[model samples]
Every structure is written in C-alpha cells, then in structure tokens.
Target: MMGSRGTSAVLSRAARMRQKLQSSLEASALDIEDVSYQHAGHAAVKDNANETHFNIKVISPKFEGQSLVKRHRMVYDLLTDELNSGLHAISIVAKTPTESGS
Candidate 1:
C-alpha cells in the first residue's frame, strides 16, 4: 500500500544508509546491523531516535590500499547526514576482501 504523501516507496533509514554506503564505496560485501537495542538509554539526545546505533562490516576494493583512518573516514563521509541528525554511534569494520579473508 502506498502512503498518502508518497513516502511509502521510501526505503527504511538503515536500508537507505546501506545503499548509500554500497554505492559510495563500491562495496563487495556489506553488513549493516541495527544495534540500538544493545545501547538502550545510552543516547545523548533521545528524541526521534530510530536506528541510532549500528555495527557495519564492509569489504571493498576501495579500501584495499587505504589506512584504517582513511577507510573509516570514507565510511563516515558517506554517512554525514545520519551522523548530523543524531546517529549516536557506529562500529565500522572496513576492509578489503583480501584482508577480510573472503
């Protein structure tokens, strides 16, 4: 069923975030897990907090030659908006396929 304001087609926040990361990094593999439940009552600003915490594991050739800092920065750049809008925290494991033993 479509939403009255045409928002029904909009992907969930986590799905959209995953899509953005995949596109931005050309990720060979991506796993985005919503870990908000694990951090109950841990958020600074708890208003409208949906999908605030996450654990992301990404394997991509784009990260092959990058330093850990650079790799994390790349992922953070892709999620700028989410971070700004109260994405409380994220645990990111960014690696190349080779490094990931995959």
Candidate 2:
C-alpha cells in the first residue's frame, strides 16, 4: 500500500496520525475518516492523490479545558510531518462528548 494513491491511502494516513495522537495524548475517542470524494473533480482537487483534503471528527477529554484553537494546534503539531509530507487541508470538528451532542 506504500505506493497506493487514492482515498484509501489518505484514510490510512489519517489513521496513522490518529494512532500517533492516541499514544501521545491518551485520547478517549478518536475517529478519523476520509472525505476526499466530496471534493473530487473540484478546483482544489489535485492530480496527485497524496494531496490533502480531510474532514476529521474527534472527541477527546484533552480538549475539555482547551479552546478550539488550542486543540487544533495540538493536532496540527502532532501531524506536522504529515502536513509537510502532503496534507494541505483539514476540516476538523473537535469536541468533548458534551459539546459533540453525544
């Protein structure tokens, strides 16, 4: 799968990053899904499948005391390598269970 280039690859990358964050932050709930097809054939779509476009839904107690920006910053910091590697855009919905309507 190292050479694969498609939504699956993107999802895989996201899962890998989620695993990294889980280890680092001891998250309570983490769900990472790929939404590349929603933007497929759009102006932002890249010829290279590795190009980034993701919608992430994360629920974690780590964000309990942190502001939205701070929580996003933590995720961004953790995914710096992925960002540099190819990820261009991430649509993040971060919440605690209470805030998530759960």
Best by lDDT: 1
lDDT of 1 at 45: 41
Positional deviation of residue 30's Cα in model 2 after best superposition, in angstroms? 1.3
Per-residue lDDT over 1-102 for candidate 2, one digit per residue giving the tens place of the 0 to 100 score: 365345445566777778767877666677776766666676655684653677777787778889989989988888898887767778777788778766
Model 1 Cα lDDT, one tens digit per residue, 9-94: 47676886887899889998999999887877764748546788899999999997799999999999999988997788899999
Q: Work out the TM-score per prediction.
A: 0.84, 0.71
Which clashing pairs does model 1 show? none
Note each model's CA RMSD in angstroms. Answer: 3.2, 5.3
Best by TM-score: 1
lDDT, candidate 2, equals 0.74
Query: What clash count goes with each model?
Result: 0, 0
The true-structure Cα RMSD of candidate 2 reads: 5.3
Off by over 4 Å in 1: 1-9
Query: Model 2 has how many clashing residue pairs?
Result: 0
Model 1 TM-score is: 0.84
